[model samples]
Target: PAAPANSGPLTRPQPVSLGMNAPAGPPTWFVCGAAGAGLGPADSYDVVVRIAHPESVYDLDLYGGTTDPDEAAAILAEALVGDLADPHPGSDSRRSTTVLAQLLGPFKAVHGRFPSVPELRQLLDGAAGPLAALRKALTATGHESLLRELDARERQMGHPGDVGAVLADRIALLDRPAFAGFFDTSGQSRPFSLKALDHPVRVRIDLPERGHADASRILARLVLAQFTASVTVRDDRSLFACLLLDDATGVVTPEAVRAVQRLRSANAGVALTLRTLDDVPRPLRGPLLGATGCRMAFSGLTPWDGQDFAEVWGKEWTEARDVTDRQIIAETPAGKAFTVVRRVITGKAPTARAVTVRQVERERWSASELAHGVPAGHAVLSLTTVKGEHAPPLLVDLRGGPRV
Candidate 1:
């Protein structure tokens, strides 16, 4: 049966009959939106989790208090490495990856807890006194490779401490006075892990982007990375998982692009919102666009951004009609008289008209039309199903209500 035509936003809850009906219930909506966005009324949700930022001063665990060392390290590395440049041989990225990978696990095992941002900053500084004790511990454990990575850092620690100093500088930002009590490692603030996605539970993390823009971006990327990782290893593949990032600026990286590609196979999807293609890195712009099954360009999209969508949507075949009017020569006198009479009667030229039709290929939506032709409260969208079915670009009026 169809629902009531004038149903209000508030509706009656599902009734539970005595062992007769089993409602599947609502699925969890894990939202990651900007801080101060006031996503919704607190009473509407079962749980409301807030993050620690400058304005909203609270202690939120950065590491998520995971017992697994590898998971902890991955999250930490995602925060430090902004774009995650290719780790070529002898490159800063490679050295940085090596140092971080070797340091995180051992430090966790030895200290029985993850290191805080300030402690991590000190550990990466080659000149720091703690490195000596860490070295002795690594030596005793026969971690020759880890020791070698540290030695390499020392070698590269010329006037500027190559990768270590670069990474340490990044860690130092969080350690500043403004971020005190945040990113805590003392296990005081209950860490929220993406692993919670395994069950049906609602979670929302509000990022503080106003004053702490860089930290917000770092946290956004970290959450995205963790979400992808969690979805990949879900116990039940039948349950569909989804993540929506309200603002995805500076969150798209090489790893993230790859992760987006694998999401569909895992019965999962991610929706990212960006102001423009410029928000994505130059090289990853194409890959990220390709990875997403659904692409939407709202009104005010620049031609440059529209061009990418136009290319992705490609071209379609359509019929083209051509019409031509030829003046009659009037070879016979009777025909000339009839033509003149008809022309006089109609008050126009007497001519024969010809029509031709042919198949032609054209863009679904041209760049100019997408950029300027899209009206306010409208967007161009294209979609591809997990089974490889496709829907070409469509101009949709967002102001319209959902169709029944």
Candidate 2:
């Protein structure tokens, strides 16, 4: 089955459900959001998710898709089922061996760099030696579950000397053309500082969870570490670096939380966008936000989250009135004499000062107000300056803000 021909302003080569029971033709959909100041939903499943910025570099971590294990395995298998980085495995190149060696952290740690598999093989007595090391490497990396799965795949495809090669092949997808520039690099070392460049370069990595979030999570950390480290060395005002993570869930490491603090002085920042506070892992939330100066929230925060934001935002006082019923009745000039008697009977008379009130304390934006008072197309932004100056939460029209 093919998608209906109506892809109005949509990116092409999108995937449609072409299964047996699927519609003979794919759906024709109307765009829910119009172009201009807003964004629209991408109806189809598969997409490249490009980020192109002229004269500037970007590290984009895109994470979204089905979270099923079976599908994850299948998708990973599909991506990895080719000749990995070493196209010529028989030519005795150091590439595949190096990949396998680094893929196993403990081995790389002990050996300095992974020896060529044949070099490792020459030092070992049995075919099972590398497999034992592989098992130990998996354990050291806290990926023990993968060892069992690796053994099962080995039982299917590997012979006596193929264990290390098979394991390396499982992740060989990274070396493929789809991921060529990103994960499998020739390790170019250069004086590539954004501050030094008269022009900027933009590199966008689209890690859509076509199933297998493990890879995306790994890639996110790698990109974040590189981006943060690159910023550490330079702080040119013109060299602004941003690491953008979309749907950042478990991928946010403690280092990333600290990087938020460290990158600030380097004119760099990390922006993580998740669905809600719940999407943020509890342990890192405090450190993450505590280190960051600015925070912005759209309409979806729950009551508990609103309370947290409200508490941090603190309170402000506004004028309030305490009204006591004491109305002055106008007396005619002829009846002015009875005013003293009326005052005597009433015990008090109305005075010229008819009303008096005092200012009272209240939370600037109450929890409920934050949860509900915010209208569509507006956000509450709390900004703090490097000089430690702070501003209260402001409800701002998103469209009115200057373009980034």
Candidate 3:
């Protein structure tokens, strides 16, 4: 269970204490991995594992409170370029991302903060016309490189606008009246930056999924990108930073997978839940599974989702038994008489039994079993530690029952 929000300064590390308060029940087997040393004389700890409390929690800000404008723009571009419509030209998409970063960086530098949603739309639609003030600020500061980038943006405006149109439509979702008070860089609301993750803080941002799903998805992707980037560059790696996305349907991307791979060294981790493997792009399904340290398949997953889990968990050798029975024929009259007497008492024929046992390879958890054989409130889970140790897939009881 999470401790209450901590506010006071942490002068030293805090060790987690666990009490043995088992309730009365039948004996149950537990799959225990070696605990890290930080667990104290009461436990163990590894350099890769540290415990820290969360200091603050807030919704993700597109332009996080980072001094580097380029980093912020890159994060924003990544979120925009993801989930683009099919038939989107690759070159055009690249140009859009490049121009967006170029314009966003200079604008944030010239002004104090990120542009509002409507201002962002104007910047994308007509950079030269609407951002004249930004251009003047750059020229006055002798930012020749930024001036050239602005020129390039103007030149590209003359080209096909497919990518720009696609991105504009997405931004339009947030520009509505429903989101007027939010996403404003003018300080109408408090801004949160994932870069401050070095401090121990718990944050929960509830998305408005009821009416603004597309906007919510865009914001979710933005939050995910910022988190991956922030955790990578944290100055203090002592605190174990973690991000949990309850329903990460379309937010999984190749960059996110690579970031997950790097979390072990950064002393951070991310937990993402999905309704189905179908939510993940077909090409990334295998890579995502292989990248994560832990994999879970709940009781209600479809056979296809189960098949993916089955493949990753792979097969193990188990013993198979075969039994055969053969009727005995009496060669002698005495034997036949005895057989008849026994048969008369038992009311059945006498037979001899043979047994064969052999080792055979089988799936650890087959697709059928994962899809239908698991009981309600149970799931199959496999875990891997930071030291590269792993535990085979095992059935987990979610409702505090015996785990196998």
Best model number under TM-score: 1
Local accuracy of candidate 3 as per-residue lDDT tens digits, 194-298: 666655443445456556677767777777788788888878776666665655767777667777788879876676667788888778788889888888787
Instruction: Supply the global lDDT for candidate 3.
Output: 0.65
In terms of lDDT, the best-performing candidate is 1
Against the reference, the lDDT scores of all candidates come to: 0.68, 0.45, 0.65
lDDT for 140 (candidate 3)? 93
C-alpha lDDT (0 to 100) for residue 64 of candidate 1: 49
Q: For candidate 3, what is the TM-score?
A: 0.77
Per-residue lDDT over 122-208 for candidate 1, one digit per residue giving the tens place of the 0 to 100 score = 877765577788778888888777677667655666554356666776677677676665677776764567776655665667777
What value of lDDT does candidate 1 attain over all alpha carbons?
0.68
Candidate 2 residue-wise lDDT at 35: 18
Question: What's the number of clashes in each of the models?
Answer: 0, 6, 13
Which of the predicted structures, 1 or 2, would earn the higher TM-score when compared with the native? 1
The C-alpha RMSD in Å for every predicted model, in order, reads 6.5, 16.0, 9.9
